[model samples]
Target: MSLKFHRDKLSPLNIWPGFVDALTALVMVLVFVVLVFVIAQYILGTELNGRNKAVDELNQEMNRLSALLMRAKQDINQLDAEKTQLSEQVVTFEETIESLQSQNMTLSTKIESLTSDKANAAKAKMSLEEKMAYLQSQIQELMSQLKLKAIAIDQHKSNNQVLEEEVASLTKKLKSALNSEAIKLANYKSEFFGRLKEALADQTDIIVVGDRFMFQSEVLFDSASAELEDNGKEQLKILAQTLKKISKSIPADLNWILRVDGHTDKRPIHTKQFNSNWELSAARAISVVNFLAQQGIPTKRLAAAGFGEFQPLDTTDQDGDYNRNRRIELRIDQR
Candidate 1:
């Protein structure tokens, strides 16, 4: 069958050809569009697969960033804790500074008290020094008075020593004057005896011995009698005148005495006028003193003594010695 014949039976014969040509053209256009869509879909799928691989790599980077953010948060928390501790230390330092300022005020008050005590002590020391100066002046005055007393005592001792020396000088002068007077008296006695010896030189019955003139008792008196004979009285007158002449030449200050001593022989005698030789001898001495007084001789210058047989001139018991023992002696001496 022909195409035109199949078309006539289905459609009107006049429009069938145009419609068939249009439908065929439409189917060719649909087939070309479908082919272009399939090629576009394959190219899009290949690009999608590359984009998926890049997305997986981005997810792994985001996970790493999240872990780093968690660690940064922990560090911020530790920094906050340290800032709190530093704030507490600053408050404690402020309290310590306030306590030190209070102690400085207390020490300042103690130093002011010490300064006041030092001023009071200086005033007391000055007052004590003034009192010591007054006491030293009083001690100096007492020492001056003691020195004046010592000088007065020394002067008194010097005067007493001078008076003692003057008294000793006067006593020595008196002793020297007495010794000169005694020597002059002795010279006068020696001159008087020498004159008596020259006057009686030719008379054998009269002899001079030492400082005395000795005469035999028989020449002056009778044996065993007290009376002076005539010749004895004449001889005594001559002796009295001689002594008177010599005494006038002597110094009046020299008071001299003529001593008459009568001695007897060793013989016992008993007579009516005498009991023994001692009485006879005494009477003979007294007779001679009385005769001299009558011859113008001073009685004050005459003295008499008597000696019996005890005054013998010769110790042998013989007649010649007995005659010599019986004698009268005159001596001149100081009264």
Candidate 2:
């Protein structure tokens, strides 16, 4: 009985814990296999979805291509119709031209024969005396026409001369009257009246300076400020309008030059806008030029220069001579 008891203890019932552990291990292995299968299914499904999207895009592109092909076919049909119309018109025009050419050749032959008969008749009938009389009559007619044309030409020239004289007289009288007012202002001593040629001298501003109509710098602009005053702007407006008309009369092919020179007082100007009298003078000159440009003066014919304190009409740096350095000079030339 004792041996049987020991055998029972050694049997399967005593090793039940070992059997349970082995069963649990086998169940865990099965669960791991199921997890791997689930992950593989998800990956395969994602790949299929991506392939489906690519196919849809390809189909859309094909639809667009098919539409473009249809439009191309329509354009080709239109071109074919136009080509056929042009070909038919060309054929019809060629046939008409050929028919006209045949008729023209026949008429030309008949005209040549008739012209020859008429020329022979004329030659046979024309004696030297008759020819001389015909020539004399022709010459007389030509002389009469030429005399009339000459008379007309003389009349036109006379009219033109009178008109030019009248224009000159009017302009001179206007300028002379303004000069009288300027002469009153000339009492400033530093201020120059009349034209600016005297102040500008041989500079580019005075292309041709006449001594009789000359005035110094102060007649044209403000001292050290190239800006034209109201009085100065008005003077320039009249001059510019007059000169524009004069320039047009000279001929369309001619070009002229007009320059403005800005002279400044001796006082220096140091600021953000102007560094010295040079800049001030230049700005003033530019102002006058711009003012003239607004009055229909062509910018292509305009130029501005700054003389600074160098172009003093009074030749002195005295405060009283401040007016002498301010000038806007106008010049003209044919180039």
lDDT of each: 0.72, 0.58
lDDT per residue as tens, model 1, 1-335: 69989887897448888999999999999999999999987887787566556545555544554454445444445444444443444344344434433443443444455676555544443443443344345444434544443444344344434534443444444445446556776677777777766777778999888878888999999999989999888778778978888887665555688999989998899999999888888889999999999988889989888887778889898898999999999998776
Q: Candidate 1, overall lDDT?
A: 0.72
TM-score of 1: 0.49
Looking at model 1, residue 68 earns an lDDT score of 49
Candidate 1: 10-residue stretch with minimal lDDT: 124-133
Most accurate candidate by TM-score? 1
- What local lDDT score does residue 269 receive in model 2, on the 0 to 100 scale? 77
lDDT of 2 by residue, 202-306 (tens): 444223333112224455554434445676666566666665655553322234456667666677778777888888777876887788789997898788888
Query: Which ranges in model 2 have alpha carbons more than 4 Å from their true place?
Result: 1-226
The parts of candidate 1 lying over 4 Å away from their true place are: 1-175
* Model 1 pairs in collision: none
Score every model by TM-score.
0.49, 0.34
